[model samples]
Target chain A: MGRFVIRRLLQAIPVLLGTTFLIFAIVYALPGDPIQALAGERRVDPILAATLREQFHLNDPLIVRYGYYLRDIVSGNFGTTFRGLPVSTIFEGKFAVTLKLATTALLFEAVIGIGLGLWAALRRGRWEDKAILAFTLLLVSIPTLVSGFVLQLVLGVQLKTSLGIAFFPVAGVQDGIRSYLLPGFVLATVSIAYLTRLTRTSLMETLRADYVRTAVAKGMPRSRVLGRHALRNSLIPLVTYLGADLGALMGGAVITETIFNLPGIGQQLFTSVYLRENPVVVGIVTVLVLIYIVANLVVDLLYAVLDPRIRYE
Target chain B: MKNPSIDTHPPADEVAQEPLLVVDNLHVEFATRQGVVRAVNGVSYTVNAGESLAVLGESGSGKSVTAQAIMGILDMPPARIPKGEVRFRGTDVLQLSEQARGQIRGQRIAMIFQDALSALNPVFTVGWQIGEMFRVHRGMSRRDANNKAVELMDRVRIPAARQRVNDYPHQFSGGMRQRIMIAMAIALDPEVLIADEPTTALDVTVQAQIMDLLAELQRESNMGLILITHDLGVVADVADKIAVMYAGRIVEHALVHDIYKNPAHPYSKGLLDSIPRVDMKGQELYAIKGLPPNLLNMPPGCAFHPRCPYGRPNCVTDVPPLYEISGTRGSACHYYREVLDGTVQ
Candidate 1:
């Protein structure tokens, strides 16, 4: 198992390099000059622009610039923006905020999704099942952009002012962990819907399996039959989805972060892309790619744990 | 060969005692979108302690469904008992509360299925699954249960029982897996063991081995055994009596030897003739004509009339009741005399 993990880690190096290079090339190819944009509608002195370009290797070919970026990356240097702020420095606390938000979203997705799914599966063809199916459909239909703003208005703004409940802050991370609740739910909304449906289908299928019938014949109570015999098999697919979705929640937080005004890496990523900060953009993407690879590896390892038929070797 | 030692019945006084299990006038139905499927209609049979009764039928004959109904494991939303009693030692288990029925299920009346691969939980070790019978029913410690599991595995003749006990169901061969299933079913020393097509999924050689193992185990424990199968060949040596089912009802009931030598029902004769024989090498094997009737839309009258060679006009309009051929035999056919006397024409 250890060898399998090590081999997987070794295989990830090429993936990391390929993805980072693609992002680097794409950002370099975007129309518009970052140096020219830096002057912002005013005419920049040609000599000063030339000196800045030379320092930042703006005249170098894409391959040479990428080589320099790789070298610096290897040496623990993520490079600097036009404002002379290091990319790593910009990422320092913001990554933690994004992590917190992603974790919160994941927790919400798991608890509510699996709970609703089990309920729906067990009560299949009943009113409760129909109600849960309808609710998940509604969640899936609404996009995060709409859900984030709408929830903010009702729960954060309206309730705080009219009811004087002060239930949640309208914006920003001033209230620490409490501030992430609204945005986290908004980020998790669609995922929660998909997961609930998957859970329902998986649990329903497992419950019908011949082994489950044997469990029943073994005289196991309904609860033990479901909890022990059915639930373990049902959880395999859900774990795979949740593990991969962790990286997605972290990377896909742009809209939610913007609406809630949380100073997370997602907000930084949006700003950096607009300002054409190639180094910051590429650095953040590299970290995300690494995170994605690690998450997938963990998911693969978890498969061996959940199913005895699957072996890493 | 039928072993005479195991074939011995109890003394005359106990012969009159209540049989171990009785499934009387049992009806099982499924509510489907197409219509209500009457899967089992008034099927009745009795199994005595220290005896084996084989319920013979092809697929969809409600043999397995009858077994599931007895176990109280039928999913009731779609499956409704609606009628009949499953009496174990004179108690109607169908009337008992689910909790009470559950207590009787594994501890008193255990069951094994045909496909051992799907029947055994894949993720758990064989030891854990076998040990579960003890842990859940007897409240044994994990270690004690595991030790008991190993002992049971050995009893079922699983090679290297101690080493193989920790392996998953997928790791075992088909024969070995079935042995594990048998071990698990018999772990609690239940008075009755219901095996549904237990040897159907196994190869011929392995099938013989498994049947032998079951018979040997039955002889040792003297538990009443209900062997449900489609194969007439597998039942000859193991089962003392046979109940052949057609559609959802028992069409024939007799001693195994009587059914083999001369079947009173044409359907039973048809089944016996279908088996290939060296003496009839040049002739094409006889097949019972037509398929079993659809449960949703069964043909009126005798369910087997369409397939019976001697099917007559009344056979089309009148359902045949089980007529007593002798004190210990019955056949659900209007012309049992003609079929038995070879006067069908």
Candidate 2:
């Protein structure tokens, strides 16, 4: 196990390097000069612009710029933003919020989705299964932005209008759990639909396996047969999907965060890109990529725990 | 070793008089996308206590379906027993409530499947699953159940019962896993043990060992054993009575020795002739021509007439009921006497 973990850690180094390099190249390749954009169209001397370019090392070749970027990252100098603020400070604050939102949304989706999935699979061909299928289809078909807007309107506008008071906050995270509920649920809604469908299908297939029949023949209680035997085996496919989709969700959060006006790294990156700020966008994107890589590593390790057939080596 | 005293409470003759399990006119059909396919058609048989009945048939002959129907394990939508009565100990198991049926499943009757490895859960230890029967049915505490589970493992002759009890199903060999399955089935000392092709998946040596173990265990417990298989050789020493099923119906039923020596039905004779024997060296083994009839649209009269070499014109137009040829033998054919006397041949 130790050897396996070491191998996985070593493997991750190249992945991190490759992703960081790709993001660096793509960000640098974007049109418009960062220094020129930052200075705006004020009547400034060309020499002053040249001096600013030289100071920022913008005069260097692309490879030299990449080398400097890698060196600064290694030296704990994430570089100053176009506004001259520390990149780390901006990232740390916004990342904390994004992490909290994503974690809450993931937890909510996993619980509700898995629970509903088990219920639906057990009650297959019944009205409850149909109802869950309909609700999940509706949730998955609608765009995230539309879901966020509709939820805001229904829970935010309609409730406040009818009840003469707001039961759910319209936007922003505050007021403890209540503040996080609407936006968190909006993000979780679509994910829940996807996860529930996956869980139900996998569980149904697992329940039909020969081992399940054997367990029943052993006179195991229906609940234990379903929970202990069927559920655990069914989770293998579901876990794979969850692991693969984590990166996509992190990328998708930008849209969801914008629609709901949540203060997360996604919103920060959006604003930074609009302002043509290089440091914050590059830093956040690199960190998010690192997070995705780490999540996949954790999932790979977790696979061994879930299935006995998987040897670490 | 001292001679073990036989169980005398249930008198041998009286026990034979009472049926431990009766499957009456069972008709199981599956509703496919195309149409309804009849899997088991009007199949009926009875098992007496302390007796081993072998339901012999080839693959796709509804042998396993009949066993599953008795166990109440058939999925209802696809597999519906349209007409049947599975009476266990004078109670109709099919009509029983799910809870009541579950109560009787492992405690009164148990089953061992063909593939031992696939039948056992890969994640859990074999001992834990075996102990589950006691825990679920008898409500034994975990520690007590574990001890009894070890005892069962030892009874089935699984080596190092104490240490190996903690091992998962995959840790054991194929033969050992089958022993574990047997251990689980006999854990609760069920009255009827249904072993569906118990040794079909094992080597000849392991097959002999499993059969020996089953016979020894059955004698000790005096339990009714129903051996479902296609191999006649495997049942030679174990089965007391043999029921030959062909295309969802029993074509012949008789004492094991009697059927082997003088098979009354043409299909049964063909099955016996098909088995390669040590005495028949260099001779081409007999093969039953054509496949079993399609249940959806079987032949009008006899299901086996199409495959029977001695089939007559009347065999295709008249369905022969199971008729008694002697005091202990029965055959479902109109020309049983003529076939037995070699007149038809």
> Looking at model 1 chain A, which ten-residue stretch has the lowest summed lDDT?
A304-313
In model 2, the clashing pairs are none
**Chain A: TM-score in each candidate?**
0.95, 0.92
Cα lDDT tens digits, model 1, B6-63, are: 2223345544675778899999999999999999999999999999999999899999
- lDDT string for model 2 (A108-200, tens) is 788988889989999998999999999899889998889889989999889999987887888777765676677777778888999999888
Off by over 4 Å in 2: A1-11, A40-77, A311-313, B1-16, B278-284
**Each prediction's DockQ against the real complex:** 0.85, 0.66
Report how far off residue A242 is in candidate 1 (Å).
Answer: 0.8
How does each model score on lDDT?
0.91, 0.85
Candidate 1, residue A11: the lDDT equals 87
Instruction: Give the per-residue lDDT digits (tens) of candidate 2, residues B5-29.
Output: 2221334564455588888989999
Interface RMSD, model 1, angstroms: 0.6
